[model samples]
Target chain A: MSDGLSILLSDVDVGPRRHPFLRVDHLQAAAGECVGIIGPNGAGKTTLLKLCCGLIRPNRGTVLLDDRPVGGWRGWRGWQGRRIGYIPQQTEYNSHLPFSLRDVVAMGRNALKPALRPLDGADFEAVDHWIAEMGLHDRRHQTFRSLSGGQQQKALIARAMVAAPRLVVLDEPAANLDTRSRWQLRDIMERLFRDRAMTVLLVSHDVEFLPGACERLLLLRRGRIETDGPRDEVLASPSAADVLAEI
Target chain B: MMDAYFIPILIAGAFAGLSIGLLSVFIVGMRMPFIGSCISHAAMVGAVYASLFQVNPTLGALVLSILAAAGVAFIHPHRRHFDANTGQAILLAFMMGLVFLAVALEEGSRTEMLGLLWGSILFADWGTVVVTGGLAVLLVAFVIAFEKELKAVLFSRSLAAVTSAATEPVYLAFLCFCGLILAVNLKAVGGLLIFSLLVCPAAAAYQVCRGYRSVLLAATGFGAMATTLGFLGSYVFNLPTGACTVIVGTLIFGACSLVRRALAISE
Candidate 1:
């Protein structure tokens, strides 16, 4: 509660069809900590991130970000642009949607302003910067459907980061990338995090891809954190063995 | 082959071209072509009641259409609880019931009951033309102004809701707009035949266009084309203009589908 990088979840519950899909009794990710959430498939790792992002409200408890209830934090677009960046798992975007890579990336900026005005000079610069950063300059003008898996994943990351949010929540970003692309992303994330004081909540099953990039870890099992500590400590814990076995 | 009735047919074709084009685009994007059909058919019941009550049949149609649209929205039957199909079914049934009621109320002027079935583009007067034309123009302008916002809804309703877009009100407005258009154009197109104008062009456009904007534009174009060609074909063959227009649209959709398939195979 006293920490500057603050996220507080108290008795949170999320579900589908009134079934207990996820439950978090209490947890906090203080500022400047890249907390890695590792869990089995359907373990509600993504659900937890969704709660923090205010994309889904808890059925029971409160989700507070920076000492304020998540719902009370107005203007999701403004908050996303300035405070939170979300990179969802790669999926087939609607092919019928005509947004170019640049347009998709610009959505990140739009989420910040929620206005109908044109993207200004500064917005263009941010987009260009992130496009280069993600190594997606070549595909910037291409239709989103035309990009390869790795290229699309990079583009998604660039889109998430274009607003330069303080906290970037990446959900299985490396899920669809090749080993080389994954490493490239890791390096890019390292460089980006170094340039600014940022918090990253990365949800992934691939623990190896993250330990070097993340500062801390929260291992989730059946919707509860079984282990949470520094990267090395949690990685070496018995829960890690259990996590690996489950995976 | 140009009869004295050519002027009336021409005017109906023109107005139908614009309004049907706009309607088809909405039908295509919302992926609810059946809803358009259901609404039009249900409007028939409303039109019948209005005729029986000696009131403006179009107004009755509009009210009923809006009610039907709301009913459809409320009874959303998908596991997601938002799909429009079940509501469409309900609407279709309601329209049939209205037709039955209208048949019972036909104590005299049975031809009037038949009027709702086989429409007369030739009987359209200057007032009807003006109203239909204005509605068409208004529909086109509304689509142009709200294209992006509409596209966002088509992309994802949840995303639209999250992004400060009043999606429910927009959706309701669209349905109401559709109702108004249906009511105005009911005389020229006939409720039984309006579904063709609403579905054919948009379905064709969706077969080829990759973007929603282009699909809308193309659907509008195809709608106009179908109406014009159908009118001409109807005149030459001594056929029903409304039904012929729909037939023309279906043919165009078939052609587009063939072209799409050939291109896919070639690729």
Candidate 2:
């Protein structure tokens, strides 16, 4: 009911077959809220994240972003800029592709600007800031596939954040990262939420990787949200231990 | 050192080489080198049908190639029954079958039919030169104009779709461009040899280049070099022009691979 809600999903069903693969009756995220989505494998966490970002539409339901329907927002050019940011579970980059760390990060700015236009000074500055923030300045010129797993994750994070989006959706971003990188990722998410009031939807099977700023928790089970409430309440619930065990 | 006849041949070869070389980077980069093969065979089917109907082979080739490319695009990547690559393969086989049928049905001189199959770059006319040159220029201009969009799609199509709304249109346009280039150059390179020209140069460049722009430049340079050298070799050895060109391209790719191996060992 809040006018400041960043995302709203109502009666959503996704996937083929007589029985939908994933269904969400109702879900809402207010502006500046960091919602951690934790679920076991096959619980449709990634699908829920994709639905939020309009990468996959629901078979039946209305999804809204900032008071506008996602279908309409999808029509706008550079919709990711200042609106939605998504870092998929897999980066989907080809090893043969000659994209460098800087090039990957620059794509964020290019997504905002018109095609064929070169990056201006402000764009470069923003890119530099994110690269430095992600501690990737040393490897900025290296081919993306040449970097370590942690470095690649950081670069993808920088790419997702470079546009200063209103909502950031990350699907299992820390899955392949090491312990140090996972902690660093949590720190980055916390900083972004604290300093910029950036709304975040972090999907992960690992609960420890969730940022400290994540106040809301949604536990997905078999394509449905079995528990949705404040992080502490969800954690203290009787089924929380079972969910942790399932993961 | 070029003679009057050799000059037109070289020019046509260069135009087709440059255009195909540049586009090949995308084909190879996207890991869909078979797309070139698919579109070229579709063009071949078009040319055969045109010959049977007494129509413009170039127009027929373009139309059929576009339809084939679009068909590949229409197949969903997540289809349970048929994937995009499988769909392309089916289309290619169907087109190739139709081409042979059309050739068999024709009662005229088989020389023309063989020309479509094997190509005759040595006998290229002013018309071939003009069409190839115009298409080369158009392809170059398109790459320049949509460089970012193309890069985005090349990097990742689904990611590009999420970032920019122009991904689908740009992707379809890219496929259409592939069809156009294949159709226009069908006579010079022949359907059978065009795939090698479209992939070998780019694959060779990819072996050495560390950046995307460098790969594009190197691929185009390698394609032109191979085509010219192959033409000279064909002229001196009295061999098929298309076969000679493809052989040169394969040699370049093999040499580049060896160089890459040597560099990797030294490092």
Candidate 3:
């Protein structure tokens, strides 16, 4: 309903047992903010993003998106929870089902439809518009798996946008892409921010992966946030460069 | 083909093939071919148990397979202690062991048991025709009604749910329908070869088809043609219908493979 999502994480602790311990005593991102999350490999950045996306539950505390519970009680992601568009790491999808890029992008409307309803002309129009927006119209008929990694990543971004999400979260979108493709993605990322006043959360090891719109940075290490401030201020932290290099 | 007695069987074969052909796409796409094997064995276990109680084995087969399918569909893969394939293999072996035990303990005639385990299309009655036709219609209708949602879950159920697609109930219902369809056909197609019908045609379609709709249409067409030919095989050669159906399906796969190879060479 709002132009963007306002996120709040309060006293959140996840998987203190079988997995690495992740705790966020307090964190908040206002509407339309571009926040970059960078941390070491074991820093629980993915876990934190998963929490924000309602993919996992916190053991100790709650995540609130726009003042509503991140994921509803008893593991139901309510309307508020559904407004967040999440593109997980590429490796997370275990199976490739040979869907065309067009069909795959159309899946963004899936979360918005009722149970028995098929996507309509309007949905396809949105899909086509985003496909053209992402410059993937020529290859819309190609199987998603047949594309290059950057192309697939672009398709995923298009997939996230079709839902008209208030918050868009991507985890390592440019991880395995070539230098040229990564730079291309950076342009798209900047364009995405410039076109919409929506919240964006990007998790990447490469600081340069963050778009120029990224105004704030959170440096995480060993499941803890060491620096949470403006991009320049966090980058200016004495330990930020060393930690970023190690991860 | 127009004979009064043979009409029901011909209708049953076409409808059954149509439904099974559609399900094969999901099974193949999920990369869980083992689930089919497990369901067939589960149906066998149910059949043997029904024989133990002097009841019609079809009833038991339907109930047991549906129950087993629920476990496979409803439980999240990550929640399990082991891999999905491993769990299915374990379930299949356990069902096989149970089938043997039930067979050993029972003193009833083996005729009904054999009929269920090795289905004969010639014995298909109007009742079977109705059940099979109903399942086929339901599967087709479900696919149409839930096209977008079904595509999402097929792509990846978790991703669909995370994106806020109401995939859980739809996915569970899809699996329920698939289980029911497979069980209903078990009496006419045999427990062993039922899985072939559910996988072979769809897999063959993948060799040339570019999209989901194409595969669905092609698989169903292949299935209908194979079933018709198989019926003729029974009439002409007096061989087992299931074996004939499997032979035709294998031929289809082989031809498709050749087509793929030829296309590759040309390219």
lDDT of 1 by residue, A1-247 (tens): 2122368899888776366668888888877667888999878898788777666677788887776666533533234323566776543234345556776676666445533344578888898888887878877777776677777777777866776666778888888678898888778777766566677788889888774658788888877788889888998998889987897
Tens digit of per-residue lDDT, candidate 3, span B32-132: 78777778778777877887897887788889988988877745653344677888888878887887788667676777666666678887889988888
Tell me the lDDT of model 2 at B239: 94
Return the interface RMSD of the candidates, in order shown, one decimal each. Answer: 4.7, 2.6, 2.5
Model 1 agreement with the true structure over B1-267: per-residue lDDT tens digits: 476657766776677766877777766656667778777776888888888888988788888888876665444221123345665765687678778778787898777767776665766777776887788888877776655455545544433333333344566677778878877777777888888788888788877775556777788889879878888888789898888888898999999999889897220
lDDT of 2 by residue, A92-168 (tens): 55644778888888777656776667677898889889999998898888888788777877887788778777777
DockQ of each: 0.19, 0.42, 0.48
Q: Judging by TM-score against the true structure, name the best candidate.
A: 2
- Candidate 3, residue B253: the lDDT equals 78
Off by over 4 Å in 1: A1-8, A16-18, A30-33, A53-55, A64-86, A89-92, A112-129, A166-169, A176-200, A223-229, B1-57, B64-124, B159-199, B206-213, B260-267
Lowest summed lDDT across 10 adjacent residues in model 1 chain B is found at B74-83
TM-score for the first chain in candidate 2 comes to: 0.92
Tens-place lDDT digits, model 2, residues B1-267:
657878888888988888899999999887777788899999999988998899988888999999877876656442233555677777778888988898889998878877888887866778878988898888888888887788877777656666666666778888899999999889888998898998999999988887778988999988888888888899889998899999999999999999989888220
Task: Give the 10-residue window scoring lowest on summed lDDT in candidate 2 chain B.
Answer: B74-83
| lDDT (C-alpha) at residue B168 in model 2 | 64
Better of 1 and 2 by lDDT: 2
- Native contact fraction of candidate 1? 0.08
